[model samples]
Target: MADRRARIVLVTLSDSFSSTIEAMAQDAALAIDRWTPEGDQSWPDATAAVWLLAGGEETAALDLLAELPTNGASVFVIGSSTDHRVAAALLKGGASDYFALPGDADVVRRTLDRLVQQEGERQAADSFADAERGSVGFASVIGESAAIRRVVEQAKRVARHDNVTILIEGETGTGKEVLARAIHYHGPRAAGPFVEVNCTAIPDNLIESELFGHERGSFTGAIAAKQGLFELAHGGTLLLDEIGHLPIELQAKLLRALETREIRRVGGTKTRAVDVRVMAATHVRLAQAVARGEFREDLFYRLNVVSLRVPPLRDREGDVELLAGRFVSDLATRHGLPTPALSPEVLSALRGHPWPGNVRELRNAIERALVLSPPGTLELEQLWLERDDIPAGDRAHSLLPFPAPLENIIRAAVAAMVELTRGNKSEAARMLGISRPRLQRWLSEDTNEPTDQ
Candidate 1:
């Protein structure tokens, strides 16, 4: 499969232009499929497509661009129009590149060659990564509950189709990325890159450049041309983690790139085409955000085309003990300690407690217990279980009036959760029952607040 010849699809209404492109493709030793506008046509198995726009055929070209199945295939448009606006419109509509008719065949050939070479390199890199990671199937997901099984089955079905956009919604630490990776490794584009970008981690000033690449000297600090996550994810999947945190301004640009299958780098005049599947994961309900005007309604519709919600830990009945046992064994092995058996009482406690932080919290708790316990059967005392076992006296003392503002108390609690989770912000946010962004804002405000003299 790696040695298979690259294929090209040529769409044209002009016989002369068709002859010219066919000649160029033939000279380049590439397989080509030629189609005309007079009939309905399906793209043959091709790595790239070239659409020739004829005079007074802008509508037809735009229609074809909209109708063409991207499926990680690059599509370019060629026309005789010198109007910069026309070219811009075509590129924004979905054309990878818009070249004037009687354009340099050498440049087209060179571009095609580059695309093929880059694909080959990508395949080689994917092969290496796959080998290192092994196979990521539905089984890798750790849960036997019906809800989880149903999600896995749906993911398997969707993985069979390569071009569908997927939106995954869940509470933090519900394994959204794990599910995304499972889909990618099992899909048609499994032999490509799987790039991930966290929306909340990047600053607003740099988000665009981080997503769409930047030209050398594009900004004050950019000294060299850099490829963005979208371009690097070419021929594979791009996981936009916490996409609900994306800024409103950048959301529009993101929608444009997803709609057009093309992106212009920061300070770049040329719009480059990218072939990548986008999978977005968010804890925030985007529909509500759309109503609130925090998220774009059009982008919401686009991303919500196919949505999957991951079930929280509490919702997966009887899975807690199973997951806890697995975590204990895995952590014990990693730490070179003997696996401890959970007492029936401990199992009961585990089953009763609601895991607000989901799998991550459970994993961390088990790891913490193992590190502190000696070689023996684990007792309830070894695990730091959150229980309602506080004595009446301690509970009464807890109500003592503290000389601190409500904001100060909240700031202290947030800091404590952060510390308890060992700097795991996502888990801290989940345990605090607040969004990560809100938690961050609270912490930021606390840091910036004036200290008492």
Candidate 2:
């Protein structure tokens, strides 16, 4: 009789043992799907699956067991009470749980339930990998370098706090959100929701409402009452990526929300209480921004309670190779293709280059390589690099056109430097080899002023 709830295949050497196992499974509310010979067999599709064994068949069973698909499945083994050796052997053979039979009906049922739960988790992981841009809690930040290890350790320590806000600062593609999830899932609020909002993605005008929500008719196009990220992340962690980009108007309200532990929706009189931990990340140099009046001083102080900086991939030596292999294996598995081998030159070029875009960029490179390369292995020629092929600093110098007026060129250089350094006037002036005031005067000078050729 085939049952759909759970599947069990008895592979015992004796007919009596198989009969006993089948009867016990039926009583325990598990499905005894079939009895199969040791050769050329596959387990039935079910939530929880188990294999029964009695030792001494290691040679035959090992080959058969290795052939079973372990992905998205929970496996267990049942052994005879006297076959203690068999229990150990089955466990070593990759069975999730090993038990001696005739196992109690309740114990059997409980084991089945546990395996089913595990199977569900496996399926969830698969879904997450396919659906989301990245994995949370399950995948680590993906570098074994000392820099990454230090960040991971600090995150673990910070996660112990119940209400402390964390500020993660780093260059773009430095994996700030990955560390943020590590803190949330490993921290005191592990059971709560982990919500992320990209401050840069939302328009300046809509930001306030996005964070605090609004009642119907509060603004044009807001036809219905809405819950904001604060409400959505109640009793959990909310990650504000590119937080330095948050407009000044919304910054004040965010600070108020954090300080008062309450929020008032736009066009609504009622204030609702919320308990959420804030984790802010930025590619911008926020200290410089605060000094320049672009970012709020009080908000900066509030979020800087515990600051973590993720080192760029270039700074973390050997991380590129490690990450490339991981990405290659993962992408292949996801696409349902055989894992392609990576050549030495591929690894060397990946490591030698400074990944300005960091891990996210490397992942894109590998995914492209996997798609474009021949079926067997990935060679250096297959990798596509727009910026990686040329040094970034070199490219910056190359962008400047020659034969243009020196004054116009100087002004252009200054502007580029200012933007590159995130508007650090002092750094820009130093790079131009001029006094800060002189640089300012030049920028302040009329471009239309008659100049000596």
Candidate 1, residues 74-170, lDDT tens digits: the string is 5677566768787667766756566666654555666667556665666677677677345456666889999998999999899989989999999
Q: Deviation in angstroms for 351 in model 1?
A: 0.4
Instruction: For residue 106, give model 1's deviation from the true position in Å.
Output: 30
Report the lDDT tens digits of candidate 2 across residue range 354-433: 77778877886687678767765675755655444547786666465677989877776766555554466775665444
How do all models score by TM-score?
0.66, 0.58
Q: Cα miss at 144, model 1 (Å)?
A: 1.4
Candidate 2 lDDT (Cα, 0 to 1): 0.70
Give candidate 2 regions above 4 Å deviation: 1-135, 386-453
Candidate 2 TM-score to native: 0.58
Q: Cα lDDT of all candidates, in order? A: 0.77, 0.70
In model 2, state the lDDT of residue 250.
81
- Model 1 gets an lDDT of 0.77
